[model samples]
Target: MRVLVVGGEATIGRHVSAELRRRGHVVVTAGRSSGDVRVDVRHRDSVADMYREIGGVDAVVAPAAHGTTDRLQTLSRDELLQNMQGKLLGQVDLVLLGQHHAAAGASFTLTSGIFADEPWPGVTGGAMINAALHAFVRSAALELPRGMRVNVVSPTMVGDSVDSFSSTFPGMRPVPMDALVTGYLSVIEGERTGEVVRAYG
Candidate 1:
């Protein structure tokens, strides 16, 4: 299978990309500023451009999102919108536009986070966006045409980035990137749709 992994240069995305390659699947990586192709998911045009460049693929995995990390009190309206524009609408836009570019029976795996189910300080924006993605995946799955599938991966703090996030996610046992990648692979390779595969330790 040929797979396009957005944010493929990042920690989790890198793991997914590597594992897919090891399984003999052709992989293409895309990001805003890195990877085999560039895509700013916040904009529909950019997402469309990315699909045009890649042509069509059997799977599209997104392990990246852009959002603000400020407390609710300190978050401005613009900051809240920024998070929605990127993480929530960005991934949603990819699915909407990608339907036209993906092959029959194609699957889309999107990334959410533990914050959607568990709260932490200064992550209101992220939590909301994550939860929204989960809901989007569930509802979108029911409407997708031509055997398309949609799912979301909600992973806890990743072990590789524990140093940077441990303080924020106190008491949270960070899950290994390799383990989280497995959940993504299930969505990519399995027949499940509208599922929220949790990778929590």
Candidate 2:
């Protein structure tokens, strides 16, 4: 499969990209600054441009974080909108515009987080956006044409990410990196749609 991974420069996206390539899939990593193509998923035009540049692919994986980490009360309106545009609407734009570029029955795998189900300080906005991604997958999957499918991977902080977010998840165990990667593989390589594939350690 020709897979496109937006934000494949670091963290989860990096791991996912490596695994896919190791499995013999043609993986293309894209971001605002680096990768086989340049794309900023927050903007529809950029996403459109990315698809145009790369032509069509069989799958698109977005294992990236683009949300603010501030308490809801303290978050300004601008911050909130930016988070929405960066996280929720950004991935949505991928699916919306990608339908025209991807091959038939193509799959879209998006990244959300454990916050959607479990709360943590200063993560209210992220939680909301994560939950919204789940909702979007459920509804969009039903309406997608040409057998296209959409799913979200809501994973707990894993491995290297533990140090950065451990404060928020007091007793939360960092999910194994392999488990999170597996969740994405199942969604992109398997037949499931509208599913929230979760990985927790």
lDDT against the true structure, per candidate, is 0.90, 0.89
Residue-level lDDT of model 1, residues 20-48, one tens digit each, is: 99999999999989999999988889999
* Shift of residue 114 alpha carbon in model 2, Å: 1.1
Per-residue alpha-carbon lDDT of model 2 for 20-128, expressed as tens digits? 9999999999998889899987888999999999998999999986576897677887787888997889899999999999999999999898889988888888898
How many residue pairs clash in model 1?
Answer: 0
List the lowest-lDDT window of 10 residues for candidate 1.
Answer: 64-73
Tell me how far the alpha carbon of residue 54 in candidate 2 is from the true structure, in angstroms, after superposition: 0.2
Model 1 spans with C-alpha error above 4 angstroms: none
Using Cα atoms with residue i matched to residue i, what is each candidate's TM-score against the true structure? 0.96, 0.96
Candidate 1, residue 151: the lDDT equals 97
Query: What is the number of backbone collisions in each predicted candidate, taken in the order shown?
Result: 0, 0
